[model samples]
Every structure is written in C-alpha cells, then in structure tokens.
Target: MQEFTLEELKKYNGKNGNPAYIAVNGKVYDVTNNSHWKNGEHHGYEAGNDLTEPLYNKSPHGDKVLSKIKQVGVIKKD
Candidate 1:
C-alpha cells in the first residue's frame, strides 16, 4: 500500500473535482463514490481528515462500514 502524510492527503478533499479521501486507524480510504461524501463533506465530517475518532464515537454505524470501501493508502506520521 502507499503512504500519505496528513498534508499530502489534504489535497484530495473532493473539492473542485478532486477525489475525496479520509484516514482511519492509519489507513486511507477512497470515498469518492459514496454519495454521502459528496464534495468531501459528510454529516459535518469532512474528507481529507483523520476520522478515527468520529467514526468510532459519532457514527451511528460501526467500523464495518469501512470494509466496503477501497483502501488506497496509509496515513503516516511526519
């Protein structure tokens, strides 16, 4: 898998035709096809961000939802 820094991943925020991506548990997922993630924002949770906490605490669903998406990269530390 590929590795992406937080800053590098920020470029894919789904705005202006860019793809949307989010990091969770150090993994990066491509959510561009999910309508819920249109424009990189979903239910107040924006893409190009580390959503480990929000997905765990705020989401009505569980991490099982993550299994459906494609993992494109990893969120690496600086």
Candidate 2:
C-alpha cells in the first residue's frame, strides 16, 4: 500500500460529515461510512490517578488519539 504524510491528508479538506479517508495501493478513499470507525468512541479511553486519591479516566485529545491510530497502522490517508 502507498503511504502518505499527515500534511497530504490534511489537504483533502474533509467535509463536515466525512472525517476519514482511505489509502490503498496509492489510492485515496473516503471511508467515512466504514463500520470500523463510523462511531466516535472506537478509540480507547485514558486512565489516571488523581492527587485526591481517586481514579480518573477520560478520552484523550482527538488528534492525539488519531495519531496513535496512525502509528499502529490502523488509520492512514496522507
């Protein structure tokens, strides 16, 4: 499959209803409706301990979470 830099992906000017693109064999695909990532919560959560002696958990930043997905070869467009 072809690989692209993050900059190239950002140039697509994704539509409001489409947030994802696919790249296979140097081709670009707008897989916004793909079942794999159609939902927003597909990304995992984050857990941390608070100074108050309690546990805290929340989702990471969208960009950070997406970056991790790219690192794992789960998502890539540009």
Candidate 3:
C-alpha cells in the first residue's frame, strides 16, 4: 500500500469534490462514496485525518467497517 504523511493526507478531506479518506489503525480508507461521509465530516469526525482514536473510542462500529471500504493508503508516522 502507498504511504501518506498526515500533511499529505490532509488534501483528501472530502470537500469540494475531493475524495474522502480517513486513517484507522495506520491504514487509510476511501469513504468517498459513503453518504455518511459527505463533505468529509461525519458525526464530528473529519476526513483526511487519522481516526484511529475515534474509531476505537467514539465509533459505534468496530474497525471491521474499514474492511468494506477501499484502502487507498497507509498513514505514516512522523
């Protein structure tokens, strides 16, 4: 998989026709087609950012949800 820095990941914020992507467990997923992710903001979570914390602590579902979405890349640590 491709690797993306947090800065680079910020570009795909699901805004202005941009693709929506979020990182979970260091893996990046493209949620552009999901209505819940419209405009890249879902339930206070913004796209183009590592959502591992929220996914584990705030989400109703588990990481398994990412299995259904397309993984476009991985989030690289600084």
Candidate 4:
C-alpha cells in the first residue's frame, strides 16, 4: 500500500472533484463529498484535537464512504 502524509491527505479536501481518505487502524476510508464527515471535521471535532476531550464522537462510516469513492475509481491501489 502507498503511504500518504497527513498533509497529503488534506490536499484532497473532498472538493475540486477529488476524493478524501483517512488512515486509521491500518485501514483507509474515502470520505468524498460528505458534508458531515470530513478530514478535519470528523466526529464534530477537528483532526489533531485532544481525543480525551468531550467532543462530538460519532462512528464514521469510512468503509461505506470508501465504497462510494471506489465505485467511482477515486480510491485505487497504487
């Protein structure tokens, strides 16, 4: 699998017709075109925030999100 930096992932932004992905637990998730779930806005708290803090913790449908992007060939093995 190709490795991507956090800054590289942020470049996607789910805008400009590009897909987004988040690497967690050795898995990649495609969150493209999702208004609610985004790279920095996942779980209502921005990325790099303190996990212990009382923030919006929601189950991110990353798998499902990846499926959508894969269907469109946005996320592919490099």
* Tens digits of lDDT, candidate 1, 1-78: 989999988998989999999999999999999977878999998888899999999899969999999999998776
Model 2, which residues run further than 4 Å from truth?
A: 1-6, 10-18, 39-78
- Per-residue CA lDDT of candidate 2, range 1-78, in tens? 444454454433234543555333333444344454543212331111011111113423322323233321222433
Which scores better on TM-score, 3 or 4?
Answer: 3
Best by TM-score: 1
| TM-score between candidate 2 and the true structure | 0.30
Residue-level lDDT of model 3, residues 1-78, one tens digit each, is: 989998999999999889999988888999999878869999988999989998988888978787789998888877
Which residue pairs overlap in candidate 3's backbone? none
Answer with 1 or 2, whichever has the higher TM-score.
Answer: 1
The global Cα lDDT (0 to 1) of model 4 is 0.44
lDDT of each: 0.91, 0.33, 0.89, 0.44
Q: Model 4: residues >4 Å from true position, as ranges?
A: 33-78
Error of 4 at 35 (Å): 9.5
Q: lDDT of candidate 1 vs native?
A: 0.91
Question: What is the C-alpha lDDT profile of model 4 across 1-78, one tens digit per residue?
Answer: 555554565565554556655454334455554575564455554432222223223444423444453321122335
Query: Could you tell me which residue pairs clash in candidate 2?
Result: 4-78, 5-78
TM-score of each: 0.93, 0.30, 0.90, 0.40
Please give the lDDT score at residue 68 for candidate 2.
31
Q: Between which residue pairs do clashes occur in model 4?
A: none
Ranking by TM-score: 1, 3, 4, 2
